[model samples]
Target: MTELARLKFYATQAHPCSYLPTEQATTLFLDPSQPMDAQVYAELSEVGFRRSGDHLYRPHCQKCSACVPARLPVADFKPNRQQRRILSRNADLQVRAVRPAFSEEYYDLYARYIEQRHADGDMYPPNREQFSTFLVRDLPFSRFYEFRLGGRLLAVAVTDVLPNGLSAVYTFYDPDEEHRSLGRFAILWQIAETARLGLHAVYLGYWIKNCRKMNYKTQYRPIELFVNQHWAILT
Candidate 1:
């Protein structure tokens, strides 16, 4: 076993669950002092760990197992009619993958996204500090995929490239572009990019069964869920 295999983890005290408000949630986090990299991250991801900012963690709730780690096996994925339409709808948008950095244009869109779409959520009342801490981190594998139309920035998909595949960290878009379904489009774009790069899968964080916000994840057919210490297809 490697050093990562012997890594220590600490669990958080029970707190209000973000997905299910009625329940409490505890998170098991990798030791922050441990040096982490793409290789170690990929190893942890295979066992259902996820990254939030610079922290690698997974839900460790005692009473609920609603947050299931999910990933798309790129080779076996087939987009449905609606997903295909989303791709066609946003076909004109140009995508560019750049290093993760603080950008005025990106931050403006992020603020608007949080204000308009997630006003009631924890990220509401967004500010520069919160924005930077959440998305802009110093990680070698991190990338900010900018979606532009006629040179105007419209959306950004914050992704991390792991050894095995890409991890979809977070996505934000112009509030006015709701009709375009840019959020869904971002995931579809990642799937295509992952396939083009010969990756095995696209890790799409946790999928909570009872969370309406997470229901969208299920639309992507043939998603594998990490259950009982194994990756199993959710039927």
Candidate 2:
């Protein structure tokens, strides 16, 4: 008989600070070389822990419920007329699944997006290594979804493939095409990807109803929110 392998990790820090202004937040930074176990990842996710590349993190701040784990039920998802328009507008774009990599094209698109969409934000323009660290670094289970238009790279979405469903970890797009609503389109693509893979849910991270940046998530109907430490259906 063979014994199953185990993963070992310890908490590093939950610094007193918040990721969003109105919400309190804390993160547990894991050692780079720590072993990652499937059961542990799944368990952590249910408890509000999120995986970014190779890091396993959860919100541990005091008395803050703004960052609730938001997910969409793929089976019950229905694109309204407006959402369908957004999809059709980007119909010409092509999605290419490639291994994560850093390139002048990707960086330029990211910079433009940040400058136009998130200027004066906490995330300053990241250098190449920082971008790699943010996107690739210690990824235990991840994939890169690259979007191209007319042979030109338009956007990229880094996702973590979990046992139960897909998680949209981070996304960046060509800010030049803001009118195309690339961010919204990327989300729709994620939901479609989940359905194609026969997955049940698409985890969209935290959603703060009052925050402008988090409000877009609510547009997806028939969603579920983690409330009172339980998954409750919210439309």
Using TM-score as the measure, the top candidate is: 1
TM-score of 1: 0.97
State the number of backbone clashes in model 1: 0
| Clashes, model 2 | 3
Q: What's model 2's TM-score? A: 0.87
**lDDT for each residue of candidate 2 in 13-130, tens digit (9 for 90 to 100):** 4454435655445565444475666555656666567776567776655666667888888899999998999999999999987777677888887877777888757666556666
Model 1 CA lDDT for position 159: 95
Candidate 2 stretches greater than 4 Å from native? 1-19, 22-24, 29-33, 37-39, 138-140
- lDDT tens digits, residue span 134-233, model 1: 8999799999999999899999999999879999999999999988999999999999999999999999999988899999988997899999999998
lDDT of each: 0.92, 0.76
Best by lDDT: 1
